[model samples]
Target: MLLLIVMVNSCYVPSNLRTVVFSSVNNNVCKRLDGDIVLYAIFVDSKFTNPWSKYDIETTLDSIRVATEWIEQKALEDSVDVHIQVAYHKTLQGRVPIKNDFSKKTLSGTLYKKPLWSGVRDIYKWADKIAKEAGLSMPRDTSPITNIKNDLKNRERLIARLRDHYQTDHVALMYFINNYYSDEISATFDISNDNNVEFSIVSFKNPSVIAHEFLHLFGAYDLYLTQYDVKKRDKKKKDKLMEMFPNEVMAFAHRNLSSLNISDFTKYLIGWKKEMPVEYQRLLLKKGYFTAKY
Candidate 1:
């Protein structure tokens, strides 16, 4: 009898962790019926010292275009008017001292000073000093240079400038290279990058990381959890189920570009169907060399 009780308790533990209860009713706020939805892609200049290869930039841009087109197509299929503008700017300078690479000790003592490197690192450090002087606390492991609060201010200023110049509430997409701190930061919009548009900093090696993060801007929660904690387990097991999915565009591990596949989950997040063309959707669905969701 004791053994059976212990077994039952253990079984209940996993289920209890998985369950996520929400009191609010499902409003279906994302229903198809709505006014014309507009999305803007603002490509700021690459600021890092290591310039992105022209071919790579073109390739990355093309991929983004394709993804945007896919959303437009889906929107058309659902009879939604989706307008997306792609803006390009070459003047934005890269910010520096890529975080998450060096240890806390290394970052604390290091004084980044050089021509291009100095400029980038200074912006980050100056922000930190300003925040401390203002009596604000910084986030853990966050350097003074890439402080979230400061970055948002910078992005807001940039967005304001862009809006004044363009005359629209355009969604911004800022691109960067090697912004990863220690191969730990997921490729996507850093919280500091928020406020103006959905910022995406894509490392040369992690171009697809942008796709994953961009999906979030559209309303998709992360399906994959390579970093799951047992204590945080839930009853629905969405994370566990996502692991079963193959290594496609949505997953974190596809090497070849052709093997990418955008899942329905992603389509729903970016409001793709509500704002894009049907042809673009079909093209994206069929172009990638991967299997459809079973």
Candidate 2:
């Protein structure tokens, strides 16, 4: 009976968690606070032939350290307690080939022959095109658009597997090489990358991308526009992103260390504050941003 009760209590429910709130006093802008924020870093090692080289390992660790430090510093400013955990695992398959010349290599040689989640081929293709356009050397056997979709699907499975194994509430942040198939591979968010797992991907080259996606996991909306419809807009009431909250983190990509800032808008989006920036806060409030039901 006791074991049954423990098991039942361990299961996750949306209502169990309380809404995060930020407090302010006097004229001073107060820091936002929350309970410990847990981070799990997943690394796919099979992408390289020599996955465990000293230099490679050191570089990976250093990158992880830098990312964690950034998160910690920002969390501190917001008065939120952050607890980060990094887990590394090699892919079951051997190294995925690097695709350079399409003519020289066979399709099999240019592909990462791993079990992919459903509905990822399109994403892999998209990521690949983006990488090519960016003038970066394309990986031999991968497509970012398609591969990332598969990876995100796989990442979701990984989280579910972990949750079932440990019986705990664990949020995952996946770190892996972009399959280079799509421009959209920059970042993404979902309740579960697939099923019961909430996961997001961070491109290995752009570490700060994870920061943006994680904000989504915390229930923030994207402030940037991907595609615009000119016909629907009146000149007078444009999107107004630039006019209000110019310093907003969600408004732009944090590609570098310097661009990272915890703005009032972000604090409010994550339920860390009752009052957010006036310009955008009203919309969020109307959309029930302050309401804890979500």
* lDDT string, candidate 2, 90-204, tens digits: 3344322222222212222222133322223433343333223222211222434543322222444444334433344544444344333333243443331222233344444
- Top TM-score model: 2
User: Model 1: how large is the Cα RMSD against the reference?
Assistant: 14.8
Off by over 4 Å in 2: 1-34, 44-61, 91-157, 160-168, 178-184, 192-196, 228-239, 275-278, 284-294
Query: How many Å off is the CA of 133 in candidate 2?
Result: 32
Q: How does each model score on TM-score?
A: 0.47, 0.53
Per-residue lDDT tens digits for candidate 1, residues 1-294, read 000000000111112333321111111211221233333333222232244456655666676666556555645776667655555433224221222222122221222234634533543443333223222111223335553433323444444344544555544444444322343343332222222233443443443555454444444444554333234554235455455446545555334534565555445434433232334233223343221211
Residue 88 lDDT (model 2): 44
How does candidate 2 fare on TM-score?
A: 0.53
- Cα RMSD (angstroms) for every candidate in the order listed: 14.8, 14.4
